[model samples]
Target: MVHPDKASTDRTCSCRINTNYIPLKLLYLFFIGGQSCATTYRSLFMRHLGMSTQQTGVIWAFERVVSVIIPPFIGALSDKSRHPKAVLITLFLVGAVTLSSMYFVPQEESLNLTNSNVSASENVTAATHVDIEEYGQTFWLLVVLVFASSFSVVGIYPVLESTVLGVLGPQNRYKFGHQRLWASVGYGGAALIVGYLKDRSAESIGDMTGTNRAFLSMFAGVMVCYCCAAIVSAKLPVRVKRDHEGFRFQDLKIFLKKPDACAFLGLLFFYGIDSAILEIYLFWLAEVKFETPSFILGASTFIGAALDIPFCLAAGYLTKRFGHKTLLCFGLGVMALRTFLSAIVVNAWQLVATESLRGITWGLMFVVICSYTSKLSPKGLEASCMGIMQAFLFGIAYSVGALAGGAIFNLMGGEFLFILCGSATFVATVAFGMFSFLVKKKPYEMKDPGDCTSSLAFGKEVAESSADVL
Candidate 1:
């Protein structure tokens, strides 16, 4: 028989746990929905503004660098903050302001430099056609706004994921996919709507060009969604740190000594390369190579994001059945397939069909990576671990991929680039799968201080074997 006091306490705890679900779902919906508004069509926006592919890639690479540098610091700060929700609110506001500012940046009217070679072939002297100083100023302003947005936007993910994981606690971690699925719903819905709005805006005759019209609608949606997310963030349960007082650099040594962690980070870098290539260039292929309409491009993202919803909902079951490492390999394999198909597709619809695999590649992959990282992180360093993981996945790896992709696309064209990305992903996936099979390391656990020696010894042995294999 349960004592009255104990039963009451259990009921209260259960109620608190139940309350987090709605807010978590809404948070994912609004935040990711906000990002999808601009992210899906950003390349097109810049292109419409007369910026060259290389210029856009440079901006993207710089933005990713900021993502790498900012997240770890933000994560650490969030971990230590007495009011973590306030930190999130501030990030939301910063992102809202900076991203919206991009919509207002004046579009380059006279210069249409799509490639460096084009600029040379046209024999266009900047002094004859346009003022070089004014052009440089406009371009640099876009860069500044994008960089400012990056500081807040990229930093938000790690802190948000850590907070969600902390709220769900260890036992309920798998249910993360359930909460995250709402992001797909929000993203898909918003993408579809925004795409429709862009088409409508494009059809209208006005002083503003179609790109500016589309961007105005996108910025409006982004701002509204972010503001709503900020408002809802206040209701989030503040995580109480019980195991340690604050995050310390020493806590990270435990993570660095684990061979599995090291290997996973390495895998994340390659994964970032594959993903970055796809995200940056796929639309370019459809729009430029195949002449796909804006609405169809938007429809493709909607379809992909819609597929993500089901996959995300089933992520927990899939993780349990196949395991994290296997699922990661599977996701990589699927990415390779997508890229290979993208290289061959002669039309936009077929490309869209191939992109339908986005759900399997991203939705399953994201949940598994976050869960695995959370499992590996030390108690007080959850946010820090997530931040580092994001740095590798989005920042460093993405920067490399973006720069390389841009150069390759300029020199060799999109088909060859996609083929190269496919082959690289395939090779990396196979290698990582084989490595994990040979490693057979015990699953990571938060160890007591006394267990450090044994853990370090095991890590050393694993490292030695890995070096021998290499």
Candidate 2:
């Protein structure tokens, strides 16, 4: 019984909402579902695969090396082609395939060669057999797959951030925090689910075989999530303006001229080192030192991620009121305090308690740094600027940090490692706070003035202005 005119108006409104609102909501869902599969289970999977602490560090270092080399090229390609959504979908598909391959790699069987009455010749034979079977084809295949998947997947965040920034603009940049809170929810929920599954499996089948099987299943689930992410990414609206300007080498030089940008990058580098150490070693600390159950280990992550939800949801409002620089310094300071507290933990529960600080530190740091980077970027080169920032933070800084932290852990144990990283983070926080004093803030204009309907009059004025300039 609706009138034709009313029906037509309703349809138009629906289209506008679909075009504007749904796409961003889907991006938020993408973060939630995608991170649940990737970050929540990756370290646990590697540990289940029997990688030692040092060996795990080497693999992560190599992965970061790939992250360093690939993201910049991908960023530039996204800018020049103006098809970032397509690029993101392609990367997700490739990453899914590579990640799935890891689960199928065969596990090497351990050899027990000890015997009281074995002859020298028999001992030699056993030694040769053990050497041949240990770390064979399957082990190296997993390493290669990890590197390949990491290279494909690591560029995702910067591109996604660029797309979000394009849609939100500088004035509405605070909304980015609330959007990212969904990712925290996804990560926490996924960790809890995976943890419960692993615990049940272990109870039914015993720890060794059960945990390994659970790890394989987790990787399989990650593949499915990545596929879903690819589908969602395809639907994302593209708004970044594409010009014939192509990629310019000078675009890279723009950040160099700004001292504030340089200082921010430096702070990111040191903090990257601190974060890398924690990511690589935290579970190892819990498992080896505290002898925590696998489910409890996962619960700790869940708790930390859950804490992030509220902080991230409020980050935009806080940033707007207190300023990005203040938040940045505050986040780094929290990290320093968290690291110092983590160094003194005597029990698994205490470690979990310290992890609650992650909400204030990591959740706040990522949102603010990303929004601030977008604010600082030139009008057209947003993706490239983010890419460069990530390259510095996740690439060079992460690699050095992982390698050095591994070596330090091997030589000096966890106490010294924590102390060292905590001290360095504290120093960086102080430096960044001091550097902020020299940088002047500029007011941002949110409205576009070029949307007049008198095209003929605008065209005539443009032609006359061009002739005068000539």
Q: Estimate each model's TM-score.
A: 0.84, 0.81
Off by over 4 Å in 1: 1-17, 109-135, 206-211, 242-247, 250-252, 378-380, 441-470
Clashing residue pairs in all predictions, respectively, total: 0, 0
Deviation (Å) of 295 in candidate 2: 2.1
Tens digit of lDDT per residue, candidate 2, span 1-470?
99999988865553332245346656656555655666555655665655544555677787887787677777677777788899888888888888777777664433557477988558545643463446555457767997788867786766777777666554444455656776776677666777778668667776563235656556666787788778878877668775624445577799767787888888888878888888778777667687777677767777898898777766655665687788889988888888888888998888788888889877778877876776677876666777788888888889888878867876788778888899989999998998787667666433322211123323422333222111
> lDDT at 360 for candidate 1?
93
lDDT string for model 1 (311-383, tens) is 7766655655667788888888898898889999988888669879989988878887876776678765666
Give residue 148's lDDT in candidate 2 (0 to 100): 80
Native RMSD of candidate 1 (Å): 8.6
User: What is the alpha-carbon lDDT of model 2 when measured against the actual structure?
Assistant: 0.70
- Candidate 2's displacement at residue 236, Å, is 1.8
